[model samples]
Target: MADKPMLDDTEDVALDFGAEDELDRQRRFRHPVAVFFHLAFRVASILVYLLCGWFVDSFITSFVLIVILLSMDFWTVKNISGRLLVGLRWWNYVDEDGKSNWVYESRKGKLKGLTTAAESRIFWLSLVVCQVIWLVFFFGTLFTLKFKWFMVVIVGSLLNGANLYGYIRCKMGSRKKMTGVATNFLGAQVWRSMLATATASAAGKE
Candidate 1:
């Protein structure tokens, strides 16, 4: 018999299927424009709220500017950024019965591929942090006796808080949907298996 060659146990071997690279790319910010605007509006609102008093002489001008920025941020995040970056959207409507309802929607099936982990992190982190910042501003305004800025802080809090709450509900709704789907699938599979077993036992008895 021929002598067998010795194997090199010290060599490092790795299996690269390119899957990791693809996942890493998917986790990056694929939509630069969307990411830019997503951060831009929120940062602008915060900056205007904080520094407007120093630049603008009139309180009315500062208030109006902050409100405008807040409104713009709210609209952009609620309508545009949320949908584009996180594949989530939410809106409220009044029905014919004089009842209010909030609708939360997430991209399903193939549409979910449009979202990235980086974008989602940016969207949610900014949303939550902005709310906390506004809350701090709220208390600071109250304690400092800056009643004029209190209204501005309130507006900021409401607008940012609404988005935070809406997104939280949207996330919870998505989880519930997924859970229901999995439960239904498992139930169906169990029923099918039981039916198969029953049919097999009946055939054997015959």
Candidate 2:
């Protein structure tokens, strides 16, 4: 009788471990869809910024131009993921059995699965702030006297570096890591102001 109980308990433990392994497999094989969006957004932002600088002779206001560009860039991504995906699919996680699961099954994980309204807003706002800063620095250099090409080159390099660092960090490290040292070195004051403004707006609305 004692042996029988011990054998049953061992079998239960093995079954539980198997289920956990399956969950881990699912996580490791996370869909590449989100990553695709990330790359597409970055590439498109860079191209748009370059094109705007090349053309648009009437947009003398750096602030206005930056605001419009950043707003469109940020809000578009946020809406695409949060509003469109969430509304269309209601964005649920399902087990192998096709049963609904929580947004995050466990706290220790990467906090993955489904963009909530709050998360979407922050993502939108943060990217906007970052892009605005880069744009402001770029325009400020363009408008500066002495016309030092070196300065613009330096700032652009720094911005790209920060973006690269941030990208790598997000891919290899945690989602919340602040690896954007280049942005700190070359980004303009507008970025800070915009971040503060966005935070206030989000807080007030909430």
Q: Which structure among the candidates has the greatest lDDT?
A: 1
RMSD of each: 11.5, 19.1
TM-score of each: 0.74, 0.29
Give me the displacement of residue 179 in model 1, in angstroms: 10
Query: Per-residue lDDT tens digits of candidate 2, residues 59-134?
Result: 4453345444444444444335333322211124689999986331111233444334434344445445555656
Candidate 1 residue lDDT tens string, 1-206: 99999997796879786888769867788788988988887899899877876888999888888889889889989988999998889998999999999899878898897888888999999998999999999999889998978889999999999999898888789688899999999999999999999999999999
Candidate 2, RMSD to the unseen true structure: 19.1
Q: Model 2, which residues run further than 4 Å from truth?
A: 1-31, 47-72, 83-129, 132-206
Give candidate 2's error at residue 18 in angstroms: 8.0
- How big is the positional error of residue 30 in model 1, measured in Å on the Cα after superposition? 2.0
